[model samples]
Target: MELRQLRYFVAIVDHGSLSRAARVLHIAQPALTQQVQQLEEELGAQLLHRSAQGVMSTDAGKTFYEHAQAILKQVEDARSAVAQSSDKPAGTVALGIPQSVSSALALPLLTAVREAYPEITLQLTEELSGTLIEQLKSGRINLAVLFDDGQLGAFASMPLVEEEMMFITRAGSQFAPKKKSIPLSRAVELPLILPGLQHGVRPRIENIVRAEGLSIGNVIDINSVAILKSALLADLGATILPVAPLLSEIEHGQMTAYPITGASISRTVTLCSSRNIPLTNAGHAVQRLVVSVASRLCVSGYWLGAKSLAKSESA
Candidate 1:
């Protein structure tokens, strides 16, 4: 079908009415209606119907709309690629990041992409692991950095970095501020908040606590790592979270990370893209930035206590 016709069809679907889409497109309503009718005829299905309300898609229309949106996006990307100068990826790269991943990686990734690939536009969607997995399958994202590493049967993934998880508490708390990093025995005393049970993190935490045969008197469950950080900063709870998740706040002294010495647990973060399709240049550039920056940030924060101690001893 003609690109213009597909564009008109998409516009009607978006605006939910002939008149509104016509106004948006700077076309007359009758012309817009005729274009949609033609598109439907070519497809051999009734694409939309009208009532006292605005237009809505039929089942076939909905099916076609999905493909149509993808086609239009591809067409736009092609046009941009042809028009732009060499050595630039002039299309949008949608990135899916879990919230915990974002707290660990967003700033450095964004900065590096801007510096390295100026023509590539990035759209970031942050959700938890489960939601991001669905989105990755649905083509909602071009690439993703995820905390979940196993049972990914179809996606192509690489070790972005393996972050050693840290058990953390607030500075003023009795648990964290001491001559040394808090040992595992003192872990159960403070109130605790952690990412909800869906993540790989929670299972490892449960394993650790059980293995130690330690029980916490006050525990909180949260879905977002940012909320976990907020809770820790406020001294509301302690968290056993990934170093990447707490890197920024830990550096600023808003929170503290004590290495989990009684037991060792680390979550492997993966850079994933569609297995069937290799990443475009733009996509790979984004992936590179995220992997590089995440490693630097986490590595720097990983030795935080030791770094502080060395500095103090030297001083």
Candidate 2:
């Protein structure tokens, strides 16, 4: 089958509807359907189960989707590899960053990369850590800053820092900071607003709480960090978060924070890339800059409640 046919099939699977995929591909719906039919005929398999709602990939379609994505990625990488042969690293580099890390590092990292590698185009994606990891595996992103719970052995990871999660609330609320540290048991008992289980930090906290033989109290689930902060300011409930996300609020006296005590609830941040896929020169440059910038931020105390993870300690 032609590469165009593969592209059409992949798009159909990704969007889950022929008309929607056709819209995204900017091609006529009939043409998209024709291409998909041609691919199915060539493969002698029904690729999708079409319905009014959307299309669901058949088992074979799922398998082909994975290979098609990899093939497309390799083709793109070949283009980037050749483009990086210049005196300076020059090409597009896609980097994924989780919401928590993006709060503190996104701006500074973007600025640093722009200043240092003007020719290397940077495409940054801010997403949940789990989503970022999935994208990394799918070859959608070249590199990512992810939370290391010591289970990501499949990736090439460089430990960046261990950031302490803190108890946070509105500055003048009843749950306002009363001490420099609050016990994990007590922290869980507070009226809490937290992200859903799909978020990286939420599951980590849940597991830690479970290990402590404690249950969270009065939780209000929120997925958006901005909305979470808004809920905090409205005196809705307290939250446990890394200081990086709410640093400006604490500094400006809009919120109060206390380090977690009784239990160590922290996440080890790491720079991760796929062990199976090699990075282009631009990708490597972006990874180095991320580590450098993160170190500088932690050392300067700009990334509060973070301790740098020495390079020798990377896994």
* Candidate 2 residue spans exceeding 4 A from truth: 7-36, 40-70, 311-315
| Clash number by candidate, in order | 0, 0
Steric clash pairs (candidate 2): none
lDDT scores of the candidates, listed in order? 0.71, 0.86
- The Cα error of candidate 1 at residue 76, in Å, is 5.4
The digit string of per-residue lDDT tens for model 2 on 1-315 reads 888888898898888899989999999999898888888999999999998899999999998897787678767777888767644787878899888788788998899889988988888999988888888888878898888777789899999989999899999888865777789888888899998887888888998999999999789998888898999999998999899988889999999988888888898899999999889887888888888888888988888999988642110
RMSD of 1: 6.9
Deviation in Å, model 1, residue 284 alpha carbon: 2.7
Could you tell me the lDDT of residue 271 within candidate 2?
Answer: 92
Q: Which 10 consecutive positions of candidate 1 have the poorest summed lDDT?
A: 306-315
Estimate, for each residue in 1-315, the C-alpha lDDT of model 1 and write its tens digit. Answer: 799998999998998988899999999998888888888788899999887799999999988887777667666655655665545665688888878667546666777778877788988888877777766765657787665445776798766665567777777665564645556667667777877777666766676677888866677888976677777778877887766667777678777677766666676677788785445667766776665665565557642221111111100
